[model samples]
Target: MTEERVVGLLERLLQAKVGHDVARLIEKRLGRKLEPFDIWYDGFKARSGLDERRLDAMVRERFPTTDAFQQNLPAILEALGFDRDTARFLAAHIEVDPARGAGHAWGPVMRGGKAHLRTRVPKGGMDYKGFNIAMHELGHTVEQVFSLYRVENTLMAGVPNNAFTEGFAFVFQARDLDVLGAGGADPERDACRTLDAFWSAREIAGVALVDIGVWHWMLEHPDASPAQLREAAVKIATDVWNRHFAPFMGVKDSPILAIYSHMISYPLYLSHYPLGFIVAYQVEDYFRSHPLAENMERMCRQGRLTPDLWMKRAVGSPVSADPMIRGAERAVKSLLKH
Candidate 1:
């Protein structure tokens, strides 16, 4: 079911030629023709316009030390609608630490041990990117706490897969600006956000196809050397780009998709990101009409169901691109009018 849903969405995306149209729109927005590497285009995001140094300054002031961030976790949770008791409970179980590398969450394997949220914080302070990553990891820690301490079965103390946790992390990451109390309410930004999400989903879907295709190529040439594998990787990435991206971007056989470091280090793991985005969009939409803190608690406590069942239980729908596509279409129309 999951495979069919993902493949079906990919096929529909290709057939609809939405990428070509969106590319033209993006070019208009940028005042230049699209480049092949524009597959990673981020100009639609509201934060793209903000000065990075200014944002970093704000974050550094807010979290001057790792302890500052750790101390504010309860307040952060409460700002997201958690009651004081629940916020304190979550904050108590999560230990924030400065990371030696790019940040990640480490959930406790046993009860009573704390979940670690690690993100890089320089000696001076936490930068904007570090703060953003910390919020994402905090989402993972929160979900870990709920799924571990709140679930009925100890054996089932996690979400179905890493993708679901990534989804939850994305939900928190999306609210980073809100947590900072930085942006005023703007309905127009919602449309921009939808377009941003659609473009992102399309970009990662192409990368995922390349990732999957390379694995299949490896299977076909079992005795292939490292040099041969490198060649095959580039070929596979180029082929995928031609099929999915060339028509839209006016480029042929661009090996740009092969640029992801994960293609070298993490085999067949790229699909989870696009899947996470899909699940995150659905989860975010659901939370718009429901209480995020309460719904997230109930959903996380569901523990280790199949992905489809977990999503259905959490959002009353299976994981699908329909909502994102529909929303993007409306956004595109609205954007063109203005």
Candidate 2:
């Protein structure tokens, strides 16, 4: 889709009304008025107040080594709502590895090859953080396996872009607590989850718009000096933040939007992330009532279609911010009452 459509949808979600609701929600949680840095507020997460060390201890007892987690991969998938047969199939086609640094998923390019999930495993054991990363990477493998082996075209064996795959990963990542037997379907926690999805999308949407602006600037000023480019980028970032973020955040001309290193290293790829957040919210919202295993497989099999088409065929609606905003509005209203 055109950047214009994406921009319009993101802007619609970033409306001052929704921003105000988000501010109120944050303030309610923090027992204070909004601050400039409240833009990174994560109090909406279900695990924000839970003790991480207790979780780590629990995880270590359950999975004291990489092999322990690898062997229980099928059980983890089953815990995330997949059936036994499907979970076994997925687990059989995926391998988990110990990593020295950050975690990531690497899908096999060849047919019949297993996907590799890499996560840091301390000598002491696999902690909660490592297990969470494994869940996210396992989500990627789910998409990769279905899209590659279960689709019509292995040649074009992928979703439309990076966003959709990343989207699926978020779907699984968000349920890490549920897998650990920590999260539940309590009304307040569910609402917090919905609002967290919307708020995250809102935050990244501004940074993404700034990314788009910098890309367009480079296109228009191919001959400009590096210093000139820097000046224009900062200007674009401040303009976007002032317009979208300042009204609620009470921060003016904040160049934080342009501070992402992706703007420097990746070049025009930053938009994929906000799109990922939106798609994840959309997909997770749909699966709330639908059969997740069947529908997730069905959606992945529609490989590489136009995003809107894929969304329509998968969910009943097009990819828009309305659902997210409405969900947030309901969440904020519900949360502020208590």
- Steric overlap count per candidate: 0, 0
Q: Give the per-residue Cα lDDT of candidate 1 at 316.
A: 96
Tens digits of per-residue lDDT for model 1, 1-338: 46566666665655455566678889998798889878778888867767879889999998999899999999999988899999999999999987899799999988999999998889999988888889899999999999999999889999988878999998898788778776667666777777787898888888888887787888899999999988888988898888888888887978988878696589877888877887888898898799999999999999999988999999998777776777777778878877
Off by over 4 Å in 1: 1-5, 13-16
How far in Å is the alpha carbon of 5 misplaced in model 2?
Answer: 1.9
TM-scores of all predicted structures? 0.94, 0.95
lDDT of each: 0.84, 0.85
Candidate 1: count of backbone clashes, pairs at least 3 residues apart or interchain? 0
Q: What pairs collide in candidate 2?
A: none
Model 2 lDDT per residue over 149-262, tens place: 888888768788888988999899888998899987688888888888777887788888988899899999999999998999899999998898888877688888877868
